[model samples]
Target chain A: MNSHHRWLLDQLPQWERDGLLTPEAVRTLRERHAVDDSQPGVAQIVMGALGALLIGTGLIAVIGFNWDDFSRPVRLLFAFLPLLVAQLFSFRTLQRGDASPAWVRETAALLQALTGGACIALVSQIYNLGGEWPDFLFWWMLLSLPLVWVLRSSSVAIFYLVCIAIWSVDRIERGAPWHGSPMIYPLLLLGLLPFWPGWPPKRKLSVSVRWAMTLSAIVGLCSAAIFASERGSNFFGYNEHSFFWLWTLTGAALALFPLNQAAIMEPTRRKPQVVLGCLWLLGYGIAMTFRDTTRYIMEGSSFAMHLPWCWGLLALLVVFAVVALIQKRWAVLAISSLALLPLAASPLVKAEGGYYNSTLSWFATLQLAGIGITLIVLEFAGKKGAPRLGAALLSGLLIARMADSHFSLLAKGIAFIAVGVAFLAFNILMSRLRRSKQLPAS
Target chain B: MKSLPILVFALAALAQWAAPLSQIWTHEQVLAKGTLVRLKCRAPDPYDPLRGRFLAVWPEQTDAPVPDGAKIDRGSQVFFTLTPGADGLSTITSISTTPPGTGIWLRARAGYVYDKKVNIEWPFERFYINEKLAPEADKWFAQNIRGDQGIVAEVRVLNGRAVLADLSLDGKSFREILKERVK
Candidate 1:
């Protein structure tokens, strides 16, 4: 047995003596047998570095070729060159099973990285690319995704995430004018879902990767929302309310449901981490609604008076505070301070519209009052009720805005009444569902 | 493992070597006009409207005909047939045909006319074709007697239809013209 197995065995004897190694535990241990051996050879290291250098050089040369002058066929062939070379190299490595595992892994990693680099270069070369940025990004992401599986490289996965994030931003910027294509950004997160609490490593690296992915999602959503709001005329904008809610709901399902199910099956101690990540993600969704609201108020010239109802912004700050308190996460607290700026700035900036226009003044007051009422209601809802209530309230606000924009005042009032009734009915149904789930079955 | 890196390095070296082979078309060569020649429409610097960029074609062997009475449409299509003039430059002779819309306007002289309103006849003798079509004449002179083996041009006409016709290269192909540069 290798040193790692030996070490594991050494620890097991004491555990067994202590009666810790039950039959089930022993079976699990046997299944996870480690065979860590000597460090990689000097030759292997040299070969890996040489291979990487060659691949890099080849990529540079191919991309540097006057692609602009080449015929379409020639340009396409050049684009696939690196992928072909990398795949062939990978196949050759796999065929030579006699090679050291470390060597195989290193070679695979190099090939994977080169493939990713080549893809980026090839995409940069596609000529006369029109306004379909999202579709373009989605295609690139999908093309690069297989490298993650083929090479088993997290780096490729990270690259894929970055592309998706960029795509999301592009989608948001195009607004309603942007028609949907086959590319779905949510599917990508699903692709990465299996790698969560990724191959055990130092805590710092794992946390950072998790944080990085989360931050990317947040930035992507925020950018998309901003784009949707501004892409059309200053008055009419894309309805991002449904988009945000659906995205957040999907995100929650992916992060929470899968992790919970996996934890039950694996009996792993990482369950809490998964839960924490989901909660933080939920908080982020709440936070985004407010951040977007604040940005709209500041940047949107027409809606300057509606600044007071910017309570979504304050609600977001509170959500962050609650998250920090619950998780005792210092990072959350540090970031929460940044939210204070909007609160301080919004009130200080005097209302810019004419005072004689009661429409502007009344709208501002209604916003502040509405936000104040929502916050009070949320405070009564307490910790357990906050997430669902926040979601419902935000959805209602979006629906109201859409109605007001698209319908007559009479129609708007009727729609508001219908929505209010629907909300109450949903709340009652949810309570019953909760009650039934909480009760023990006979 | 060691071989992997070495293989990569070898591939890189091979790529560097292969890159230069494709750049063989960059050099210029001279050919005589009316020497059957070929021209690849390679716009060297793509037109950048924002930057006010444009390409100017200067033909050294053949000059465009300037019509005397009719003003040439600034962007109208005109054809050329190679005929050595007194100036020793191959000039385009005008052949009558329905303007731009009907059949092969084969006998049309290659020249520039001002607006149709001016009615000026400035026929072949002003503009010149690229001098590169010169050495191409020797090849045509030796092998292409029937005119079947000469350069044919598909010129984009005013109505966007491509009109295919034999460009009167005295007797050469673009390859033959380029070959002179090596000699």
Candidate 2:
């Protein structure tokens, strides 16, 4: 029996003795909720994922090796072979419908996505096709979307998110043209949208789903940070600084989205957002506090805001704002609202050459001060992990910046001692708070 | 409802396979039954993300007349009337968006433009080989070809479409040259 079933068995005797349940009722409940004997465990899932990956990679290597020997038609035929087999497996799964085992359905969906990508790569090799990397990724994603919908596959959705993150990075940082990536990215997220609604009420998601979401979220946020410019064009008049501000705001919104949900308030359910979003926010906060970061953006004197990506960022911000308003998450509302201040300030300062440095210094100082105070407040409010890490990170960054700016050695030593004392005090206070029931037990 | 999704998948599968096949078929038909013209061009090696490495090419038009106010856009099709020179190498005499029916002309995309001169990109700019041979091809092209005298390409044109049939350097085809070099 699984751990959940075991725990239920342990509770049954106590429940009957305490008059919470009768013997007959306990027996009926136990029979109804019994664990399936044939359900695959963690080892099986890991092995299945590895097997699919190996087969996909091996298939590509073998075809690429013998690419010259085969006739044109033969090469073309081979490209479609793996895809056809994958489709046959998908057809069988669909025919079985819900009667198919969970493992069988998931494995078929995973193979389908892999083989489809392989098919694309093989065809491009045979034809000597030339296009940007994101174009190839976009086609692979479009072909896989139907499989996600037909199979109701969380695995394929995760796979799509992984590709979206990669395509975003390629398009943004490598100076590839937009190619509708900004628009298509969010639309693709809808493939995974169904999974969230169908999530079980009182249980954690399977380990594979949790890990996939975490990895995708991290990649997505990091890609946003690398949005240096829209190829050669700058849509937002203020340059990279404005996009940096947009990314920071987007990170905060992603972190807060899951937090506001009453149904998903459990720590396990909230782990992906907390780790990905809050860590990203913390890292951005640290980078913003540095003198070099300000100098990098302030050197350029261009300002105007119009691009598809800028509009896409705004659309996302509007969605976040609407949700925050509906949920009455006042703290989230205030943090998101703060992004507009720098958006308005940077362009005006940039129009004139002399004030750019002064404007950036003031902006950096305000962000550092704001983020530092917020981290401590979160720790006091009993939000663990991210708050503590954010606080440590903020303090380290402040110290590093202060030292780099040529503060006296005496002042630096005093600052370090003061930070240590503050941490000690925080630890003591947290323990007392926990004992007195002033903070909820984690 | 059950058969509906399966039907959609089948259609998507057919379309995916058909798109690339149609491209190959069009090129094959032109190669079999079209007018062949040898054009002067240059080749350089470049990497394609999925296909590994390929030789990126530029076809040189030494004596083509410059047109007035012709705005060339990348990926936009343009018609070029071809005439063979004394060396039996074809030179573009005129270029336009609409096809000229009187003489043999090949359809090509307007590539890079400078002043009155435009570099038309033939459909076959990339020549794929094994990934290991890409660096060797790049080295050989850099070493042997000089001053637009050695490089030549035979292009088959039909019904406003063209396909690259052979690329030669100093009288030998590229594949034959590579075969000798490898041996």
Q: Write the per-residue lDDT of candidate 1 for residues A43-91, one digit (tens) a residue.
A: 6645864677587657745554434345545765675566566766665
Most accurate candidate by DockQ? 2
Docking quality tier of model 2: acceptable
For each candidate, what's the DockQ?
0.04, 0.33
TM-score of each: 0.37, 0.75
Give the lowest summed-lDDT range of ten residues in model 1 chain A. A124-133
Residue pairs clashing in model 2 are: A235-A305, A235-A306, A236-A305, A237-A303, A237-A304, A237-A305
Fnat: each model in turn:
0.00, 0.28
Give the per-residue Cα lDDT of candidate 1 at A426: 62
Local lDDT at A103 for model 1: 56
Off-target runs (Cα >4 Å) in candidate 1 are: A1-10, A13-58, A61-84, A94-106, A109-142, A170-172, A175-183, A187-216, A219-223, A231-257, A264-442, B1-183
